[model samples]
Target: MDLDQLKTFDRIARDLSFTRAAAALNVTQATVSMRMRALEDLLGTTLFHRGRQVTLTDQGMTFLPYARRILGTAQEGREALRRVERGRVTLGSLRTMVAPLITEPLLRFQEVYPGIDVVVTEGRHTQIIAMLHEREVELGIVCWPNIDPLCLDLEPLVVMRERAPLVVSAEVAERLGPRPGIEDVLAIVPQVISLFWWQVEPDQASALCRRARSSVELPVEPALRLVERGEGVGYFLDSSVREGIAAGKLKEISPPEFGELYRDTALVVRSKAVLERPMLRDFALELAKDFRCMGRVIEDRLVEDVERAA
Candidate 1:
């Protein structure tokens, strides 16, 4: 039977009088009797004894607990739907972008919305794009310059651009000397630690691969460690190398021949997903704000470097 019938049965069972049950339900006695008749017809059993005094039948007592459980579960579902604060936001990010770009914003998000759990899945550009296509993640952080053109559904919410500088250890920097060219740096530290996220032209990529055949290719985290330990020189995002350079453990080699290299890390979401799920929109907005602030910080740092050099 439906909720109305079950409710009427429960009310009559509680009051042990159809007249009082109708009063409690704010319905006429005839309506209550009609509901009872429909329920009994559906179950093929009378739920109440009709006499001078009303009383529940054996079947009615047996079914009461099950009906109450159904009503309770329905109420719980409604309550859950109404709770705006509790939810989960799944994010996919490049391993390189996570620590430098995502960690702080994520911590701040958690502080503000403790009830909303965030699950971050780390992957390469292709993998993150695949996750978005498959509806596995709502948000993603990826290098934007040479992204896959096929994924036209992905929308870039924020693009944080920063210089990508060649980082050398203090000893390697001394050997290369000030204003060292690419060839000079390569001669000194032949095996450059390459970052997977670097977006370069086909010609440049071929030349680097041919010249630095002995170079070890690695992701950002391990590559950073190797560079810091004087294992090899690394080309990294400015934000990634900032602390090391400030600590005097790493030096930036800005060779004019190599020109100015920059990386764009974008926070992207599936446009359709954002439209379908509004919570993702809210999360994307907050995250975009954080990345904008970070972009300003990087800009200020670059300005300070220029002034100090001049």
Candidate 2:
């Protein structure tokens, strides 16, 4: 009946445990139980079947969507008011893509809206999705093919796709010789530094991971560092390793068998209703514009590289 009761119900339903929900909501377990009991009494039905494992009853399942919608609408109203009065925008981004995707675009956003405050929270895909669902952030940048916005009730605003290249330290590249085949590269250096930020298929990803004699999984920054030290070869977004490649510290290898791999980064919002706010809309537009410009620059460079190779 009340927002607090509804929020408690929603959280409890999500976590499937009153104790866990209490921890997440920063309240006592007894308080969570009291709120849920009050809600179930008000509705004149048993919501959850209390037992060793917590499971939603038929009535609870029916009410879950309505509760989520009410909570979402309430949060959106609060955000709208905050946007009008304070000009604050919050964004969530994948930790690996932050440098390549966010830095320049954020600077551009700041230049256009100097008075507005922008907060960026970086996390992996699941964390970012949770932030969006909980209304902790107004926007999120996540890897595509890895995330399906429609299924998660998020609206995609922009998708920026870029090449993912196989790279190694200059020393390793020199050892393999120019125009090395996949077999030659594998024979010389069998260890691969794996980054799972982008994957077209689970099986394909697994196969790549298993190809090397040995593999070590790491986050983007650390993996890049290891590759730079000639610890192992890495498959990374071109933008992520561009500086290193240009500085002669890293080399990009394009073995004939590896072909081309691309990664897509998308900007998404919880709902299209959020975009009705002018300030948020402006910030979103600024980010999209910057990303488009970056895509063009990358494309131009690719064309130039092809012409020179020819």
Candidate 3:
């Protein structure tokens, strides 16, 4: 009936030794025995068999799962209390992907709920998702292809269509004897920038391979930097390169489809994570709304495509 008594019984059952359990609980062996006996007597069940080596009875085995759950609930309650006192919402994201994907929505959410402190941890995409699934953070903004079904609750939101362009600095291009073709640029750039090929269909994959001169596998943004600085023509997402192009630091190559690569963004959290915290829930909703509104950015283009058919 008493939690302390049940706790003592649980520890004794786990260790199979009253002496060890007593030492663990910082109590005397006789005190441990007394608590266990009291618990067994109150429940009218003989929890453990008396012998040279202790073993659980059927009733004790049945009680084990419940005991673990009760202790877990207590720990969770204590942790939640600590989180409330701290007034912080911990979030995680892939290092390079979070800025253009979630930063604006996060800022807007902060404006609406200024009292909630938002702490962000950045790592690789896989690491970020693992932390989210493990409840290390409240949420994760990820740009991965597909998520695992095991331990996560996902909110899929297409924040933006990311397109990487094959870019070259004007100064760099002018220095070359002849401008490279798209396939040629890709092959050669990998040598200088290291690149990951995405969205290249099987039909195009062969062509890309034939022309690839470089074997470096750099991430998108850094690859673009290599291009802009004239090290090589490299691929980079439009969101990252747009500013540089506007500033006349980079120029897009003639390959029309080179800028078409894209990935969908999603918010991920542990399946059991409670979205019950009012301020935290509010922030999540605001972030979802901001992402949903992204579709409106190309509304005019959709209208034009529709009218042209008419």
Estimate the TM-score of every prediction: 0.63, 0.64, 0.55
lDDT tens digits, residues 133-248, model 3? 77788877666443455444554433444455556786755543355556555443444443433322233333444566644556666666667777676555566677888988
Best of the candidates, TM-score:
2
Clashing pairs in 2: none
Better of 1 and 3 by lDDT: 1
Model 2, C-alpha of 268: deviation from truth (Å): 1.3
- Per-residue C-alpha lDDT of model 2 across residues 1-310, encoded as one tens digit per residue: 8999999999988989988999999999999999999999999999998988898999999999999999999998998787657688899988866777677777877888887878899987878888888888998887764454434676666767777788989998999988998677777777887777753433434565678789888888788888888888867887788899999999999887667777777777767666666667767766676666544322212223223333
Instruction: Kindly list the per-residue Cα lDDT of model 1 for residues 1-310, writing each as its tens digit.
Output: 7999989998999999999999999999999999999999999998999888999999999988988888889887876565534777889988876777677777767776777767789988888888888877888887774357657566665668777777888888888888898788777777777666644433443455457637787877778778877777766777788898999989988776666567777777676335345455556656666667655322222223223333
TM-score of 1: 0.63
Give me the runs in candidate 1 sitting further than 4 Å from their true place.
1-86, 199-206, 272-278, 296-310
| Worst ten in a row by lDDT for model 3 | 297-306
Which of 2 and 3 is ahead in TM-score?
2
**Model 2 per-residue lDDT at 77:** 100
What is the descending TM-score order?
Answer: 2, 1, 3
Q: After superposition, how far is residue 300 of candidate 3 from its true place, in Å?
A: 19
